[model samples]
Target: MPYADVNGMSLYFEEHGTSEDTVPPLVLLHGGFGAGEMFQPLLAAGLGEGRRVITVDLQAHGRTPDVVGRPMSMEAMADDVAGLVKELGLPAVDVLGYSLGAGTAARLAVQHPDLVHRVVLVSMPARREGWFPGVRAQMDAMHEGAADALKQSPMYELYERLAPRPEDWPVLVEKVASMNRRDYDWTEELSGVTAPVLLVFADADGISPAHMVEFYGLLGGGHKDPGWDGADRPASRLAVIPGATHYDLMFSPLLVPVVRSFL
Candidate 1:
């Protein structure tokens, strides 16, 4: 129930783990239409055992109400995260984001390198086109009336249960849909990120395998097989968990160990 007045929004966040833990905190950013609670499976798996875990509800999502005039964008969400870090008086923290949150995390690492120590990007593509054509088409369909159409879905139910203002569901949906319609390319900016990164996705994710490899290559990974001596290994790590998909990877059993190992 804690709210940080940041970046023109009342950003809601929760902290887990003991302050006595030695490891830096990990900030968990959820995907589009998801709240921080979506990471409960990972949290229950002890991802925060030796570290603090910070989870946030991004603009117009979960407990945080949308700013009246500010449209949601990755850049703006990243700024809000940076501001939250500052407000919390932390020097730096590790960031883990999924899908929409992944894009925001990537932008955070690029725009505020000094505030990020490590990054975990889950089910995110480097560019809009990295998603399969049909996936992209599905994303394009999230227009104004999509909220009403999705009322019977779990996402809508979750929002209704958790949002500060359940009546704002349609408004939130419209904002998210509007944001989705915009195109973006973060390839150039991603190349400049200095933090060590871990890219994770399901084998059957929305992103194509070729695009996944391409994304890894941009992160200085997948260029060559690591020598037996481990001398030529890439700083970044790539993990494609079997039997998982974009919508369910967060709850996948394979996610925690991979994330813990990388961090």
Candidate 2:
């Protein structure tokens, strides 16, 4: 077990694929209400082969403890992750984040570009507006009162099994709920990102395809055609995995190969 004191809380992280691997480390960030374990399937699929893979448990999620008065916010989580990279003494690392983690990953690439070499954002959009109306409604329903009901969900089960204090489940719920209630839009900032990015989404995702295309446009994509020599292509990519949905894309077998190639 390894822990790092960062940003007023103790953060937990796991390593795979060896420290000696020549490739830059890949930081795997899990979705909201989940832990690093969600990426087990991807890691098993050899995405980490011959590279260092680091999976972090964000604040109040997984093995990381939620401190009193310390609520979970995208900004805080991004800072904590950057602090972890600094603590590890890595000049820069590749980042792959799913859902909530994707938000943090994108923020790092935008606000802390020096710490990120390349980034993969899975099932996430640059703004809350990108999500379908119903999806935003569901997020609004996530209050502390919903914690007990969510216990029937595997997300809760995993938290119970891995949280430093299982009683904090409700706390985590409220914090995330609060964070979600606040509107966010990173679209304006993304164009300034220095690192290359990969935007991956499920074909049947919460984010409409049109919005995703707009997101790509913000990344300087799709405005022009890529010439035969690949000279006009954007530094970023947009990949929508076929026959997948947001609920299951995290474990989609097709996910590993695409991400591995991008990294």
Looking at model 2, report the run of 10 residues with the lowest lDDT sum. Answer: 15-24
lDDT of 1 by residue, 151-224 (tens): 88899888998898988888888888888888999899898888999999899999999999999999999888
Q: What TM-score fits each model?
A: 0.97, 0.97
Number of the top-ranking candidate, with lDDT as the measure: 1
Tens digits of per-residue lDDT for model 2, 134-224: 9999888778999899899999999999998999889999999988877998888988897889999999999999999999898888998
Residue-level error in angstroms, candidate 2, position 31: 0.5
lDDT of candidates 1 onward, in order:
0.91, 0.90
- Cα TM-score of candidate 1: 0.97
List the pairs of residues colliding in candidate 2: none
Q: What is the alpha-carbon lDDT for the whole of candidate 1?
A: 0.91
**Candidate 1: segments with Cα more than 4 A from true spot:** 19-22
